[model samples]
Target: MKKPLVLIVDDEPDICELLEITLNRMDIQTYTAENIRTAKALLQQKHFELCLTDMKLPDGNGLDLIDTIQASPNPIPVAVITAHGNMDTAILAMKKGAFDFISKPVDLAVLRQLINSALKLSDPVVTKERRIRHELLGESLSMWEIRSKIDKVARSQAPVLISGESGSGKELVARLIHQQSSRSDHSFVAINCGAIPLELMESEFFGHKRGSFTGAVTEKKGLFQAAEGGTLFLDEVADLPLPLQVKLLRAIQEKKIRPIGEHQEIPVDIRLLSATHRNLAEMVQTGSFRQDLFYRINVIDLHIPPLRDRKADIPALTEHILVKLSAVNKIRPPALSKTALAALQQYHFPGNVRELENILERALALYDGKIIEYDDLNLPISTHNKLNCPEYAPDFGSLEDYLEKIERKAIILALKENKRDKAAAAKQLGLSVRSFSYRLKKLNLDS
Candidate 1:
């Protein structure tokens, strides 16, 4: 059996030797490259399980090499080595497709952990299967960028705060992080903080002894206990009462929880991932949420782009949702006509992905045929069309006619204000350039 090979690119001979020794101790083979050119040559010559490169290479920087490697047919997962205080550079590298990063004067334990996670992606079958299982199902630029961020965030034990509108798949993102992390085999316990009553919040989060309270008929574990060695995802976490927030902060900070009515605190090992549609920072300012707790859980932030922002992904999302609906209903998946898909793409999705799912489910139930048509969607067109309607219109007409007049007048006014700078006008109107251009064509304002 061939050993897993690692390519280490560093101009420093001592650091290269040290890394080779460390990796060899783990039964991994290493190839050394003193510069970007050597690293590129080595990469072309053979397959490597992972690559570790210093940020400043003698020939070129790591970011340049990363970009080059990504364009190649077979891209290897690469981790960067940055100066101890150079976290900004490390984050930039992560955004540019670096698997992970380690600070200089490196801790061997941290290096080993990074290596292990990178190795997981080296296996083709495991990587492919995992990507499919935890798929975000979008091809838009925003979706691609978010997936990259998720991959980087998954390898660490840091608390992640995901913010997005309701029904935007925040929980799915949390589940993906858990699935991709080392805790994949362990339980993924998710709870809606808003749904739990204030009275039961403590008992639900921390286990209680039998007869601890009136409802405590038997000894039961709480979410923390159930999520031991795994992940605890607090969905709608902003809604957690301020009083309970203090206890939650203590538990997260100490990694120990005292059950309700229990005298001792038990240790827990779990990663915390939290999500909320509300503005937590604003909540903190209003004294509705604890600032200390917010800082603790928001170590890293992941914002999911709402569906309307990534309209290009509508077709793929529609198809994926239809397939799921088909499997659950034990029927053949229905195809959407071009007109129906166009309608979906044109409308704003205020409810995000969840709304799309609901729309498809409704279409599947109501439409008896194998193909879903434009009318089958039963989408509310008037709402989106009238989104920017003026407060007063001189001429009363049908909603469609009124929307047309309002849209044309708004476009003309915006164009005149921005001196016909379509991009600037689009920005002022809070519309994407594509959407603005499409509207101009639809309303005969292109002239």
Candidate 2:
């Protein structure tokens, strides 16, 4: 809803006025500065979507401004205006963080195009900040680890495989990766492998020529092609069919794709990042997933632990989610009663972080600005007793008795839920399979 602001900096008043008029005609708000000092002052005081400055300023070189801008918290996309035959300076400008360089006799059309592109780059950062303010609001160790991984991974072009339970913030992680990557200047394409029908998978991945299929009334670019220099996040990647997996493997290996009905393979420079809730190793063992393809994508594995494993982060996560929901709904954030907080801390989030967000959102809507009490949480009452397990609660009985009861309950629940699959239950319980067998032996439940 806000028009982009463009700052035009030139030593010559006429040049600044001309560009201001042009930008104003395009419905972009303009700010004019006649020197580097004034430009820097304006930049510090206000946020401009894009900046156009002369390569040579009265007090300092435009290159100096580029360095200063790049060091700022939110740097504006900069374009250097240089004299004709100053190609060397132009190159240097770009190297110093200038988005583009324009010649002295500026062609208004070219200048407009460059400004337009620079403004477009600002959109992603703006959109990302808003989304973070809305969706991401936690500082838990698990959340912090994820943020740290995103920051580190964004600097490289490696293929990342994010494995987490459903509703565990996979998409948010993908977005952060894209936002922090070198290819942040390009588009980020995301697709859910499980949501697309098998018959349309090829068309969706490689796009299609007009008239190639029944619904192909026009030529379309596939997700891979659209994300050419950026990232392609394949959500629910385990759902990709076996046949498509082969094609995808080849594409990743060769760095190209052959669109449906096309002869020549189009070269693509995509950074692939895939996520799935399913156990990939188990899938591979069962022949449901390609082992080679798994190796290709699992170059850098980032496992987002389930929320239950990171219960220490619940308070921060709860507050963050509540604030975000309030901002989105245009209402004041509701208060969480101590009883409600205690109840939430006790529950094992089977759905993980996503379930926690949903629960908070539901509570906000249900309570409608009122204080959220324990009853308002609507979690299983049994969860409260589970929280009172001796690990967190003060011991009232012999240590041996507490340990036996906790172990018995955990084993029974794991066995029942895993349908007596001891190995699988062991993994869920974070125990070695052999140790689980010994536990069954000790409990006399081996039969």
Candidate 3:
């Protein structure tokens, strides 16, 4: 088998010698260049699997070399070595199409990991795309564009901030990116940032050594350690506390973490992916979120459009949901009546794809024979009372179950009307604040 070829571009002879020695020890071939002019010549002359260039070059900068490589017909993966403590340059290089970036006074371990990941993109077997379209579940132009964007961004090490409404499959999108990336073989660790206790946030993220604190009877690895050489997805990242956000920004910027009770900082090799339904820009303006942290995580924003905008895909989405529900219920997949399909498309989906699934699953249970009608959907009524039709009454489901559905829809409607203000929504519904909060938890709408 032919060894992988790497192009090492740097003006310093000592740095070039070090990189050449490192690659040679790893059973890889290396071609050296002193500056951008020499690197471009080498790039045109040889087919290299990966290229590593210092940020500073006597003739030109690394960004120039990156641009030249990307403009070529067949662009191999490129990485930039930035000066220590200069995260802005690293981020800029990554945005300019560098596959990854490593800090100067380089850590050889991290460099090895970065090179391996870049090389994986050149390996046909490891680089094959993971078919994840079925999980996305829409055929609109927006969905198509999202799929294309995912393909492009999966090749980079930049932090991707997935923006979408609740239940719009933000985590699913993150998982897809991880699965299709060079880090696919490693773990894809996901955690809801809002779900963790405030006191334990630091320990949960950076881990703690034995006897680190009251609960530190045993040493535990944090999400970063667990997701080493893979991806760590922080869902609902906007909910993080201000203090934790500062620590998080440092970890991401430095690519190193100091677990609680540990004296030395440890180098961590992992990709960061975050998501939120909230408007982070607004949060930043209000001083609720750290601006530096926001910039670090939101290198690239991928927005998944809500279902209402893609109503044309409703019929197909409903069919897909019904099939899954049928399999779980041990029943044949039911067909939706034409009227039912139209009713779904006409209604606005505040909870996005998640609500659609819930409505369909509930309808499938009470629906008789194989066809689900409009009434079975139990869609929330509008201010004008659209369900006033005499035929809208269906008596198949029990009173208890029917009432629960009514309660869920009524609460959803109230929340939507009041802009999700629990206090105002409770007053509008003639319920106490505590009761409203309870109802939200009971209806599984608190998230």
Candidate 4:
């Protein structure tokens, strides 16, 4: 068998010699290039399993090399070397498609681990396993961008913080990330940080001994222990109280957790993925959330756009929801009339995907026909008023077009009246959450 080859690109002779020596000891053949110009030439002549380059080079930076490689028909996995403590540059490199990064004055242990991970990409089995397709269920441009980011971020061990409105499926995004990562074989424990009681937060997170408390009849494993060698998703992480924040920070930084009433701390290995709809930066400014903890968890941030923002996906989402609802209920799924769909496309959905499901479930229960009509929808009076308003009239192509214009105006007015709160606007408009969401998309009124 031919030995796996690695390409090393660095301007510094000492660094090149050091990496070559280290890799050679591992029986990995290496080709060295003192600049990007030489590295490009070597890449054209060789088939390397991996490439490691320094961010700063005499001819060009690592980013330039990454771009050149990525533009090629088949690009090799590449890692970059950044200056010590240059987290911003490292993150930029990752976003630009670098496999991973090592800081200058790098530890050989970390370097070896990075190389091994990059080489794993060459294995067809590992590549297939790491590309777990996420069930995000949207074709909007925003969703496509998110999927791309997920694929890239899954390859790294960095902490990721997902931000979006309530019911936007942040947990689903986290699960997809876990599935696509190297930790796919391990457990994925999700915890609702807000649901746990203040007194029991620590115990729930770090577990407890049998005799630790009055109700402790058996030893319990906390989320950290339960999620050992896996991913721990803390949903609504901003809800954690100040005291628990300190403990959480310690565990994250030290990679050790001490259960309640336990003297010894247990070492834990976990990839932390946290999410919240609330503005954490604002919370930090107001002294509600810990800044240090915020910085720690938000190493690579991803924001999911609200359903209202991606109104273009309403039809597809509705179809998916209807299919799932029909399968579970063991009933023939009803087809939505154009008017019914228009009603949904025009209304603003404040509750997002959850509200959409709620509206559909309610409609399914009330209507007993193969086709769901506009009247059968039982939409709010606000939507009707939009069509019947005696205000200034515009030149209409048809009655349907006029009603649509009216609905657009009414939804926009309701959104403004309610300070853009989808739930409140939906309630005030007398439309179901799903109807409001659908209408928002139908009329292009969602912001």
Model 3: per-residue lDDT, tens digit, 160-277? 9999999888998999899888999999999899999999999999999999999799998999999999999999999999999999999998889999999999999899999999
Model 2 lDDT, full chain set: 0.78
TM-score of candidate 3 to 2 decimals: 0.84
Per-model root-mean-square deviation over C-alphas: 12.1, 11.7, 8.8, 9.1
The parts of candidate 1 lying over 4 Å away from their true place are: 1-134, 368-370, 387-447
Write down the worst ten-residue block by lDDT for model 4: 387-396
The TM-score obtained by model 2 is: 0.57
Runs of candidate 4 with Cα error greater than 4 angstroms are 1-3, 7-44, 52-92, 101-116, 129-134, 198-229, 243-269, 375-447
Q: What lDDT tens digits, residue by residue, belong to model 4 across residues 40-151? A: 9999999999999999889878999989988889878888888976766766776677777777786686677667766766777877877655677888999989999888
Clashing pairs in 2: none
Q: What is the lDDT, from 0 to 100, of the residue 71 in candidate 3? A: 90
Each prediction's whole-model lDDT (CA): 0.83, 0.78, 0.87, 0.83
TM-score of each: 0.61, 0.57, 0.84, 0.70
**Which of candidates 3 and 4 is the stronger one according to TM-score?**
3
The number of clashing residue pairs in each candidate reads: 0, 0, 0, 17
